[model samples]
Target: MKEILRSYKQTPASSIAARCIPITAKGVVRGRLRPITGDTLQNPAEIKLIAEWREASADWFTTRFPLSEAGTSRWLEQVWRADDRILFFVEDEECTPVGQVGILHYDPLKKQCEFDNLLRGRKGKFGNIMIYALITLGIWTIEELDVMEGFIRVVADNYRAIRMYESLGAEEIERTSLIRLEENGVTRWVPGQPGSSPPPERELATMRIKREVFLKLHQSNLPT
Candidate 1:
């Protein structure tokens, strides 16, 4: 029972630090964007709501993450930290949570950041809430963080998402195989090795956008 329970339970990602940088920005679809992590999601009601979104979007997560719910939770906790990890939760004007996006492995010296999981639940229904989330985060990365460049590894099969990012001036640079592995109950992605075990692998194409180019396109009014 314990083992089974660990495999089926999922939790939301959160910041572990006492003082996290606050995020506030305007989202296209509805309201505005606010950063959320374990530290900010203390209210049980909101936490449960986030979990519900994850459950409702299980098919999405299962396909991309390919992990048990508990594994997903642990991975999320590992990703939510103070130094370089950034997780932003979107909320509407009515204060209803829409979705979340984040980045990891921010290299200040190199002035680059890798895109983390960018997911927003439309309550299991179909909507463009994700586009709004991406726009909000993309703007933040270029404008606020002052990063020179950013890259995202998206599944090659996710054409809709790829097209959306491309419309925002992201260019597909390269394609490679990425494997999802769980280490010590935490799930993470790594490049596949030769003669190693075949893991949950995907053909991921790396898309990149420069700060100047993306901001320039946005200034000219990115595809609405």
Candidate 2:
């Protein structure tokens, strides 16, 4: 899996292409998950949509900062160049871009990854879009990437997201204090740092899910 990811990172952005992951419900296709690549960023509308989604969902994340189109482009370009990261924009049955999901910190040896950037860019777009997108990514990790387990860290106060993960078979494995730090105008919550003290409200919940467990729970809904 690491070799595959390393190869992907080495590939030139212009040469990279999006992959289609079928999102199914009860053996029926509901939507699709498309990997974000340099080609995907070429479309102004698509890029703007992604930026907007990220900005709107900023509060739900551990990091919060002002977002700009250029900044978004730079951030995504870096992701495209990273060996251990991949993100996908979710689409509905109608093919409307609704949100994004990604996995990072991939450890090939342990076959483990951390779920990142799970957010619905558009409000009232698809009620269960995140769930479908998550399942799609999980399938890719287990079936395609050969990852055995996955983890996700969520802000302890973010109930909505926590509920969603729990519903999808994730279990809380640990709780870590978040040290809030502000540099320039951006504010972020880090697990810890030298000479840092965490506020009581700044807590993060780490959750884990096994590949076999996730697949077993959604096996019927998965496509053949």
Candidate 3:
């Protein structure tokens, strides 16, 4: 939209920033979050993920995500300046790092944004669950911070993530098949192609959730 806070910028005096960013930096609380930026990308903590984590978390992110290495940095910078996007490292009770989660492209006017760059490097029993839990917190945090509605587009083939999102109260809205298209130096995943004999049946699952649903779920799970 070439619009408001296009890069996740933070107000120096923001109470939310003070309350959230420090804990995020401290890396103790689960789902602790901070805005991502190129400047912070090479922080010692992130460097550890690359030097320690088996997949070399840095490589995995660049390989799996749509952006190039530089592009990813730019994306982070943009997201940081916008201040709506959240980039987080999931932590366990003892402050062990588990994974990374993010929510970006938020539009306060429409009160929505897509979830992306959700990756988990931790292994074992709670490893997988930690990422999903972080995602849950990320979604709710976004809802409380800016958006009232949130949506995600999941590839039909990604059964695990789809199931997890459903577990988080997301309702599927569409299952239209899509095709991969490369035009004018840009690539897109879209439904069907004109005069292209109907693309393959593979598609994306559109899912949605509301603030109320997440809030009720969160409150219901909290101790009395």
Show how many residue pairs clash in every candidate, following the order shown. 4, 0, 12
lDDT by residue for model 3 over 1-224, one digit each (tens)?
A: 32333333332324434433222212223344444444455454554462344234433221233334555455555556655566655544444556656677677778777776666667524434454454445444553556677787777787887888787778898876666665665545667744565455457788887777865765543323
| Model 3 lDDT-worst window of ten | 19-28
Q: Of the candidates shown, which would achieve the greatest lDDT relative to the real structure?
A: 2
How many pairs in model 1 have backbone atoms within 3 A of each other, for residues 3 or more apart or on separate chains, i.e. clashes?
4
Q: What is candidate 1's CA lDDT for residue 83?
A: 62
Using TM-score as the measure, which candidate wins? Answer: 2
lDDT of 2: 0.80
For model 2, where is the 10-residue window of minimal lDDT?
A: 8-17
Q: Write the per-residue lDDT of candidate 1 for residues 1-224, one digit (tens) a residue.
A: 22211221222333222222222333233554555555443455555655666666553332434444455555556654446766666655454567777777677778788776666665422255566557667766665566788898777778877888898779999987767776674455557765558654666788998888887776633333
The residue-by-residue lDDT of candidate 2 on 1-224, one tens digit each, is 76565554454555543446777766767788777766765677777887888887787778888888888888888888788998877888887777888899998888899999998877434577778789888887887788899999999899988999988889999998778788888988878744566554477999999888898898876656
Decoy 1 TM-score against native: 0.67
Per-model TM-score on C-alpha atoms: 0.67, 0.88, 0.65
Candidate that beats the other on lDDT, 1 or 3, i.e. the better one: 1
> Which parts of model 2 are misplaced by more than 4 Å?
2-18, 123-126, 192-198
